[model samples]
Target: MIARWTSTILAAACLLAAPVLAADLRPGTAGEGNFRVNVAASGGPSELPDRIGPVSRIKDIATLLTARDNQLIGYGLVIGLQGSGDGLRNSPFTEQSIRAMLQNLGIAMEGGQARAKNVAAVIVTANLPPFVQSGARIDVSVSSLGDASSLQGGTLVMTPLRAPDGEIYAVAQGPVFVSGFSVQGQAETLTKGVPTSGRIPSGAIVERQVDARFNDDTVLTMQLRNPDFSTTIRVTDTINAYTQSRFGKRTAAEQDSRTILINRPTEVSAARFVAELENLLVETDTPARVVVDERTGTIVIGQDVKISQVAVSHGQLTVRITEQPQIVQPAPFSDGVTAEEPSTTIDAQQAGGQVAMLEGPDLQTLVSGLNRIGVKPDGIIAILQGIKSAGALQAELVLQ
Candidate 1:
């Protein structure tokens, strides 16, 4: 009887062990974490713009005759920060904004002593592009108004963005997308980029559309971004040539250096006229000028920039002084007191330089001449300024 009972017990144990063994043998039944495989897709070649003698479409070179983007501004609050927001106690405007927002939502708050360190008062700005219909999205920029440490991880509440005419144009409400972050600990703090400002892509919705006057006007104008008499003449000639070839009539005229007046033909509609003319290619004409950014030490020489015969020399003199203190001790037998003696070393040196003549029949020679001088950007800026002052640089020197 004992042996039979033992055999039955062993069989029952074996039946339970069989299922456990089978499950362990099956795939995806391991206790390890799941594995993921990522495949990268290949991309095709890219198209780059031709910088030299570049031909651009008429539409790319100039803005539409009357269509322009209007600026919209608003005030709002940004919440949800990691203690990097404005101090509510110090910023009464934030408390006021909060109170007004709460009242607008049918919530009544009696006291204005709300203390929230994770909320910041911000100024939101967005540009309403031309011909943007209702319910369209636009980007907005948010900037802190008070002493806020960071604007990361914040959500902008519903705020009405108004134009200069006091008309509400769009409504902005979205999570702030900050490319930077700020972190603080007991030992140190770390920050990158600008933490007090952020941008929200597609954050504003247009509620009203500004009426486009060009739609009903018989004549449309084209305003060049970089106005030049030569460019204006070229644009007008191109348009007139296209019209003469297609409609057998000249419909374009140059009004000024910046504006080209387009006379709409009776048969061709304004939409069709503009569509055809905007795609017409015209070689851009730029003035002979040198654009210099003083802050960044950047120099941009235009294609037509020319320099007369001029001599330029670059040299710098540096003087350095260092102080060293020495402790003087008296001998054991001599009656002298220990005292500190001061010694200073002065160094003066000047870098050697030779004057180089610049005679630019073209742009390449001018660049080579400047490079041959082996001067730093700051030195080059000074030399260029001196050349411009002496009337050696034929191009207009614009300082920025």
Candidate 2:
């Protein structure tokens, strides 16, 4: 009776485990989808003329084309460290800088006797904006140049930041705001992120301004970072239309995908003229591109993505193995020893489901089909690769 009950329980357990194993299997359809299509015009010529700016005005567009900030960098020293600074023994520059600073402070030190653990070498960086006047404050970044453990609670002592022209543009000085912390004991130390670098908000004052002329040019230029011919033409047409209705004739010229030349208006100030140009509305078109990041399983779909007619089927194949151990006992108390023998079996089977099909004729249908099949990101990559191989996918496949 006991043997019969045990066998029944073991069979039930095996039946229960089978469904869990089956749940692990998945089926997915693989194919490439097209991304090229005609983008419908949104917000017409009236919208276009306002999106970019005025056509007769030259100064406003030029201002919009300028760089946001100028990069200023310098090498400096960080002092008053709590034994967390770089070792002077290994870094001779740290010691040399410290000696020079102390000598300025009227403390004479012998060459070999200037070793100290409170000093660190650092690099100072800041950004000078186009309209930054003298005495304007800007944020600055400070990073250790040596093997300093941390820069927390350290003060930057008046580091002069210079631009590419080797002229001092800003002066940086303040308490450094390090992002990480560290603690140490005799046996163990705990650290998080990086404490050797820090930032100071509004810590630098602009000392010099870059000599740049924005309103002096007779022809102002609008430059696009990613020059698209369609976008450039739209910008040019929009500016021309605005000026024709407002100032009498077209004054904006599309020089190329990257540049547009506008004739300055005599009636408006350069600043106000450029302001009106920047407000012009121009509808721009971007190329159809499919970007795939395999490492993180991210997919970005543009609105213009399209797909031709295609069929897709997905299924899964599974293989399973089972092992059972049987025990043999000596009969009737005889002097025979008991032993156990193991039985093993292998089985292969297809998933108990119908294959899913994807039929796509356009971008909407393609996205709907992929979503309906519940395709994962990694599986999407495989499908895209397969589609590309078939010469059906129209967009550029950039895998990163």
Candidate 3:
């Protein structure tokens, strides 16, 4: 009984506090209800500064323009799968690969005939990143190239991973690690994720090194992940300022929106210069955008977004249907058929249909005005679209 009384008091307090909060709102504000817009703009909401983000390291924004990962691919076979493996008759490649393996082991087989329900042909692939030395272990992904139901609980045979130049750079062979599984029964089937694909973590041993010329070039290039003219200029200016303070001259210049060339100073080692330059921070810029996810009813507003005076009114239409079935009985001693007749009554109601005038000189006021009308997410989407069509909403609307 005490808990019940406590809950009652809490509800009463909420009811009493609601009107007091609403009383603080502007005169034109509508009644508040279940809807709200919670946006954490990059700049403080009240300030609404022009800048969208703080300083970030050059290494976080750009990649070393010269260095990149190399793609490697190989063909091999997976074995030891419990009847889920490929059918030897259907997958000729599986038989061919098995026969080749046996022949290499000094067992000469004629016609390349090999029969095994536990073996499956697969493609092995891995990305050999720059600076990876010989004997380094890397992860390899194995994918079924046959009619195998699942690669779960299977062991991958020896496979040679080769770069595009047709040179074997790594050797991959290990027990496959399948994160998902599949089960098939006569009556039902259940599966999760993809069963025909799996990965072997750190299963490939690199046998060759791809040489990178970081020191050979007198100038090093930096490539931005996202190309922006303002960001490129800022990066150039920031690097120049830092270098001028240390070396008495500007060493970096913007080559384009995506590239920056840095002259290697003679006093510093190439690696040391790059390592130090990558850590310098520069403020980043972002375009004003409002992202809305229709499926999840999520809306994100940027800090620099603005709006002209606009009006929004959202009303909900409720539809109700009731069905009643009545039966007619035959009279005693009278031959008559009894039948059921369905009577349906539909009632529709339009409530809170009045338009609420919403006008704001700033983003905060605009959000508050929209929220005060108690509009649901879908209704808000329609209203926002209408506002944008009327040239009131200034930010770009992106639908996801």
Worst 10 residues of 2 by lDDT: 9-18
lDDT of each: 0.75, 0.66, 0.74
| Residue 273's lDDT in candidate 1 | 75
Residue 369, candidate 1: C-alpha displacement in angstroms: 1.4
Mark the 10 consecutive residues where model 1 has the least summed lDDT: 9-18
**lDDT (Cα, tens digit) per residue for candidate 2, span 209-252:** 66545554445657765576767777777777887788886777
Return the number of clashes found in candidate 2.
20
lDDT of 3 by residue, 117-231 (tens): 8888888889887778888999999999899999998998777776655556787889999988999899999999899999999999888777655555556777799787678
Per-residue CA lDDT of model 1 for 1-400, tens digit only, reads 3233222211111011112222221122111223211111111111233335769899999866456677788778888887888887778787777776676566778964677888898888998887788989999999999898999899988777767655567778889988877888999999898889999999998887876544354566678999987777778778877888898866666667897666666687667778989999988878889989989999999877889998887888899999999999999999999999999999998884688898787899989999899988878898899999999999999999
Query: By lDDT, highest first, what's the ranking?
Result: 1, 3, 2
Candidate 2 C-alpha error for residue 332, in Å:
28
- Top candidate on lDDT is 1
Model 2: how far is 143 from its true place, Å?
Answer: 1.7
Clashes of each: 0, 20, 0
1 against 2, candidate with superior lDDT: 1
> Residue 394 of model 2: what lDDT?
73
